[model samples]
Target: MTQKKRIVIKIGSSSLTSLHGEISRRKLKRIAEEVVELKEEGHEVLLVSSGAVAAGYRKLGCVERPTALTEKQAAASIGQGLLMEAYSEYFLSHGYVASQILITRTDFSEEKRYKNARNTLKILLDRGIIPIVNENDTVTIDRLKFGDNDTLSAKVAGLVDADQLIILSDIDGLYDSDPRKNPNAELVRDVKEITPEIEASAGDPGSAAGTGGMKSKIEAFKITMASGIHAFLGKAGVRGLLLDAANGTASGTYFTPAEKTLDSRKQWIAFNSGPEGTVTVDQNAKNVLTAHTGELQAEHVISVSGRFKNGAVVRLKDENEEEIGLGIINYSSEQLQHFRELDEEAKAIVDSEGLVCRIDVPLPATI
Candidate 1:
């Protein structure tokens, strides 16, 4: 028997929407059936699905997807319920329970809330329930939005520590060039690392119903791979695609990082926490920080930029202003500056547990 695995599958709007830009029951049912099969095979499944705005725009009397933030939010408010009803009904028919989980960027930004969300998902998955996740688009402001479900799915996979992240899209797989513009473009089967050449090959969104393109998917892969999770990108609606993906036999682009992977706390510090200030350290301090030999000392701080409170995330920079890592500041920027001027005795400015170096993966952009 195949080993049981925890899997997170993300289906984009384009895959679930009909040509009329509305949710397709046929597509939803097909996906539900596949998920049921996976569950029956003794694997845990979590779904991150997109299509709320597309599913409700017509009900809002719009001819096309709404561009205005308020309009989109209104559409999502209406569509999210409808989308959940469909999923719940379909899964119920297959003797499985489906639960909805609406998330905002703020949920992950706050450490307490992030841990709570992870704990909740763990309970649901352990009880054999499929957790259906999506951005809380109805209430999320532009600044707090996840932008697309592609990245949200990757983050969710990392949050749940899934064995695999399967992203089903309109395209078959990653290509060496834009397949639409270049008919002879070749599909890349396996990728151990994302190179500049691979990033250059990604293209824009292929469908009006979808927000994420190949570029966003590549970024998502970087997150998952760095988290030590294997991922697959392939065409939606392919026969037994989910099973094939779990079994490592799927015909799609596969991303597998090198041996090392970040721990949960490091993943949070690297991807979710928003830096509130910059902390510049001299070369000696930089060496100690990078070596993970000791905690940062106030005496090592060259300068502190921006205002932030204690326990807030801060960017650690070298004297040359190059970003080296991120850490939770033990003192506020003002306090650190005061200590620098006073030339006081050495004091710990950042504990070792709160620091995450950028040597593993690029730090997430600040909110």
Candidate 2:
């Protein structure tokens, strides 16, 4: 028997809820059935579901999306409970357990916290429970907001190192023209790359109920693909679409993974977290690092900025301020400045040759 593939399936608001803003029980049951089948097939699955605000819209007597942030927050708070309850009851009948995990952008931005989350989810997967993730809209601040579930789904894929991510939307797949307006629009089955031209073809958000338009989905695709993970977009209401897509069926638009494997730490450094500061290096230094995979040395650095301390990860930039890489600083900014003042030969003596330089190591006074 083949090993089961790990997958992440994200269902947007438009598909999971009705236009009048209620959870579509029929749709939910069909999705639940497919997911249970996948689980029985030995596949590990994670769900990124949207519809909290939509489910709450009717409950608040609002006919549309709330304009006020507080209203939206209240709706989400109310709807999240209903959404999870429906999920739990449905999955329970199928003999499968479901767990709800609400996350903010900040959760994936802190390395230690990101690792903790990864471990927690791994334990759930080990126990044969499906982890259903969502954005914590009720308490998450502006900066922590994921903006939409598309980005949240991508981040979940990266964190779990999922083999594929399936984003089920209203449309069947991407098109050269807006299918609603253009009768001759061609359906693009395979999208190995998301160029700017293809993005221009995606006109706008289909509905006001959803936060992210096609543009946001494209951005999410870029994130998932960079981590060497496959991303697919398909029709949410289609039965067995998630399973078919995961099995490499021609059901939707497929974004192929990159050739190189993006390691877990590199994934965190590149996209998971925000950098504390930046280190500027010359062209020679850039060439050595980018082309030859060289280790950083004090002689190659031009300057360091921001309030980054020793052992903190910082972004590396060239003279033009273009990001080149990220790495841990061997010295603090003040210590780096002292090293910069010395000549190349003198600096080599201190940094490379281990000469007795009067440097203030922050820990303790040792003769």
Clashes of each: 0, 0
Show where candidate 1 strays beyond 4 Å: 344-367
- Shift of residue 225 alpha carbon in model 1, Å: 0.7
lDDT against the true structure, per candidate, is 0.86, 0.80
- Candidate 2 stretches with Cα past 4 Å from truth are 1-3, 341-346, 353-367
Looking at model 1, which ten-residue stretch has the lowest summed lDDT?
Answer: 358-367
TM-score for predicted model 2 compared with the true structure = 0.89
Q: Write the per-residue lDDT of candidate 1 for residues 168-263, one digit (tens) a residue.
A: 999999999999999999999999988889989988888899899999999899889878899999999998999888898989988896577887
Which candidate ranks first by lDDT, i.e. highest?
A: 1
Quote the positional error of residue 75 for candidate 2 in Å.
Answer: 1.5
Root-mean-square deviation of candidate 2: 6.5
Per-candidate alpha-carbon RMSD to the true structure: 3.1, 6.5
